[model samples]
Target chain A: MSIPAIASTRNDALASLLDNAINNKTKPLGSLGMLETVAKQIGLIQNTRVIALEKPAILVFAADHGVVAEGVSAYPQDVTWQMVENFLARGAAINVFAQQNGCALHIIDAGVNHDFGPRTGLTDRKLAHGTHNFAQQPAMSSDTCATALAAGMALVAELDGNVVGFGEMGIGNTTAAAALMHKLTGIPVAQCVGAGTGLSADGISHKQRVIEAAVALHASATEPLDVLATFGGLEIAMMVGAMLKAAERRMVLLIDGFIVTSALLVAARLQPAILDYCVFAHCSDESGHKKMLDNLGARPLLQLNLRLGEGTGCALALPLLHAAVNFLNQMATFESAQVSEKSE
Target chain B: MSIPAIASTRNDALASLLDNAINNKTKPLGSLGMLETVAKQIGLIQNTRVIALEKPAILVFAADHGVVAEGVSAYPQDVTWQMVENFLARGAAINVFAQQNGCALHIIDAGVNHDFGPRTGLTDRKLAHGTHNFAQQPAMSSDTCATALAAGMALVAELDGNVVGFGEMGIGNTTAAAALMHKLTGIPVAQCVGAGTGLSADGISHKQRVIEAAVALHASATEPLDVLATFGGLEIAMMVGAMLKAAERRMVLLIDGFIVTSALLVAARLQPAILDYCVFAHCSDESGHKKMLDNLGARPLLQLNLRLGEGTGCALALPLLHAAVNFLNQMATFESAQVSEKSE
Candidate 1:
């Protein structure tokens, strides 16, 4: 399976132009702080001073995780499909936030165990019923992982947007993400594991043990794709594909919390330049997420302590993106506003 | 001067109901993080489980400070009126953000040194040409201070909104805010002073010295009103009145950076219950802002390193307020979505 090439958005000339435009705005230099950085990033990604976020979309991929059989998650595996139904019915947090922020929501079934026939808002892209239990064996065959990635890429290719936010609903997938994070980033399984969906102390310990055993079993899978195939959920693999494709298309990629960032870890390893098009939405309340973000040298836009992940962080953070771009495009320069600059 | 009585929004029965409503939403309990707190706060403020934020408006009080002559700020005092003109022209940061976030922007002339005979969209409420230089004397007389406070209260009384965000534009206002912070919080003058619009180290030291001398001269003014009269800018005094009035009316007061928060400090001192009505927008990059927020025992929603004082922080954070309310109202319950709860 061939990964699309993402070009480096490192244009010194364009960077200078963006800086000039941002600095001349009718406020103190760097007083806008992180917003100036965001505006510059968006400008760089678009390769233009006039940045436009057109047809912003959030694709929430849902699937089941075989890791659920190990009692790693607080909720049953059925909650995955139930939450997807909630998304379709417009009753989920992601649905409400996406609607509030004017982003179109697309719910995709990557590899859920249940079969829903001909649903209106649900996009069918299932690679299988679910991955095999990684605690006992590899999650998916190499071909299946490739197929999931390709499907994700194809979905973005057909979408009508220059920006896409990645979200996921997969019961027990945090276990999968933890395992993937451990293998890919060389972090200990214990450090990668967390109280996913409200696990108790003992439950978290047991979850860590389960992931440790899985990581030890899949120790030979050192390459990015091999590590992903061994431990990644179908939804995660697909998100990896979607993120890569979005970056390759020069669309701004809004990345949510742990599970989504785990996919990004894989995508970034495959093509490092994809980081240029990516925006780390928030540092979630989920344990090890900050470390995961730190590992990638990412500074997230918000740290709202959000742990519920149907790309809710991404949806919440979309406004900051708009604010960043709006300030860049609409704010007056010191010259334009006739405001005095800093004292010489 | 009559300060409006602010009733505490503390109802145990209603708090229980708001918690039940929030926890029953289709997400993990406390997963929404600060947003959950904001939702509950709004619910309690409105005295109902069904929370609604209507006709949100950002009132930007623009003024000029006499303290600018003491070399306490980086920009000239005239920039205050210029930025206000920028706001009126819809080309300021606050205007751009407020417009993008569906917030009505109100530009009020609290005490700018300049004057336009008649301008559309500019609310004229000048207390004086500007405050008297606090370094040499009191910023305002007891009567003038009282009048400023009354003017702020009267302005909010006529505004048609359940939510009001406070922003300000005044050169050298941060110097005034630092003085207010020093006096109200008993924090050291050096700790409270910072780079207001790009002050150098020497400039910050000079600002600190100016504030320290002024603070010493006003040492006898221990009462909040007397302290405000001694140190606060007209915009800050007006904001104090506006904040108290807004709280008395139970409007969600979205408080901006250091200067706006200084106004809140005075408001909270006079009516301690007013803190309950405030939504601290962001912990600005402006030095001493974090300390000021800490002094109020307030946890702000966003910390984007924004130091611009045009209520840009308030406008930027408005979407999160909407999201918090939206999620509370729209999301499904565990039973409603048929999503399984945590395993026993």
Candidate 2:
């Protein structure tokens, strides 16, 4: 099975019209800064000057990584299930922000070790107990990787929104993201690894060693899916699938922090058009986020030194999108408002 | 008349309580980043953990600086009154952002060179037609400066709110802010001046020379008020007054860009306690804004390279405050949520 094609390229034919729509607004040209860019991007994506972010939702995929047994995470692997429960109960930061920003949230259990039988809120799509420890062997088989991706695609296809955001929760996912980054970008593992949740200097060094060992073990994992199967979490694979499907549907995609961005890196590599539907939410304080962002040439909306990965950044940014959309839709043009323009 | 003493000190007594309140939230300690800082600051300012931002308002002071006659600005000085009209008509960027953020904006004719008698939406607080060209003589009389400050104080004193934001409109006020920054902080005029509205490199250099000339002519003006009388716009003086009074009333102040921060620099000098009430809304893309922020030790909430100075930054930041407030008031603690704490 293969990832779905992202067929919607930005409507460059409407570029001139969009510029006039933005510039003719009763303000100095480029005064709105990044907001103008957002308005224009959304307009181009939807192929209409009148852009609406409808039925916005944040899909948080939760799975555990077997590398937690190596003590790579600040929290134990059990916290993955615990955070999912917290999300369902509307107690996490992402939950509060999502509620505040009027975003519907869905928690998907891609491959958590725990078995929550028919939980009301969780979408149970467990691929297995968890991915195998990549430090010792491939994290998932290629078949398992494809299944996880398909789970993500299926989840997004069922969602009722043109604007979607992706976030993830896993105990040792950042370590996996780091290894993936190192392999994909050929950035050093030490540079890619960061103090996720919170790690001491020694622990980070130890993590680097573990990842270096893993990379050496999987030297032939050159293909994106092969690399993902070797080191990526099931949740990451699902997010990769979800992002592709969202783009294929011509929906606006909000990409969250380092872990999610790493997934995007894989997804973008597979189908480069996926990024055209995407807006980076914020630059994470995670050590390698800047490098990943730099490599992608993505300028995020906010940089609050946030390292929380529960789609909190996406929730925080939803209002900016609203503001941008509302301004474009509602603000009177100079001609309409009868405001005098600058004598050029 | 002297600047009113800012009587309210930060509630140090509640610092520990605020910390405990923040730490006890279900999220990890310091995970919220700037949101945690905002919550703590608001909590301390109100002297209560039950902090609420009531009746949020953005006071946009519109004035004209005589230095615009020297070609110190890219736009003609008439743009000040024109933009004020735009604000009233709800056609400007500030108006759009303010409306989007649920901020009740008050446009004050602090000293714009316009005679619009009894405009419905505008607050009539005209000090004079405009300030005197400080390049030729002092900008305003000492008595005028006193009255301007008093007017700012009176505006807030009459208004009913514990949270206020400030924005200003003037074509050459960036010149005034740069001059004030140079004089007050001993930073060079060349370093302080930036493209006001939209100036070419030659235009910026000319602005620098004009400011340097003014500074050389008024070398003896050391006191804050004297400095205001020598070189400040009426809007700047009024903002200085308003900020002091806002702090005195223990209201949370959302300070805007370079012009507002320059006014804040003056207010902070007159009474350093005023700094405690201000949350630098965004770091402006202007040349000297970073220096002003550094001098004040302010870490702004947003940095989208925004240089438009009509309290647009303040309007953008209001939602973050709401998010922070909502999270603190609404999120479940680890104990209440029955989530396990980190084992470290």
Judged by lDDT, which candidate is best?
Answer: 1
Give the TM-scores of the predictions, in the order they appear: 0.99, 0.97
Best by DockQ: 1
Candidate 2, superposed: residue stretches over 4 Å from native = A8-10, B7-13
lDDT of 2 by residue, B162-277 (tens): 88999999878999999999889998888899886778899999999999998989899999889988999999999999998899889999998999999999999899988778
Clashing pairs in 1: none
Tens digits of lDDT, candidate 1, A1-344 = 69999999999999999999999999899989898999999999999989989999999999888889999988888888888888999999999999999999999999999998889999999889999999899999999999999999999999998889999999998898988888878888778988889999999999999988877787789899999999999999999999999999999999999999999999999999999998999999999899899999999999899999999999999999998999999999989888888875
Report the Cα lDDT for residue B96, model 1.
Answer: 90
Residue B10's C-alpha lDDT in candidate 2? 58
Q: After superposition, how far is residue B323 of candidate 1 from its true place, in Å?
A: 0.5
| TM-score for chain B considered on its own, for each of the candidates | 0.99, 0.98
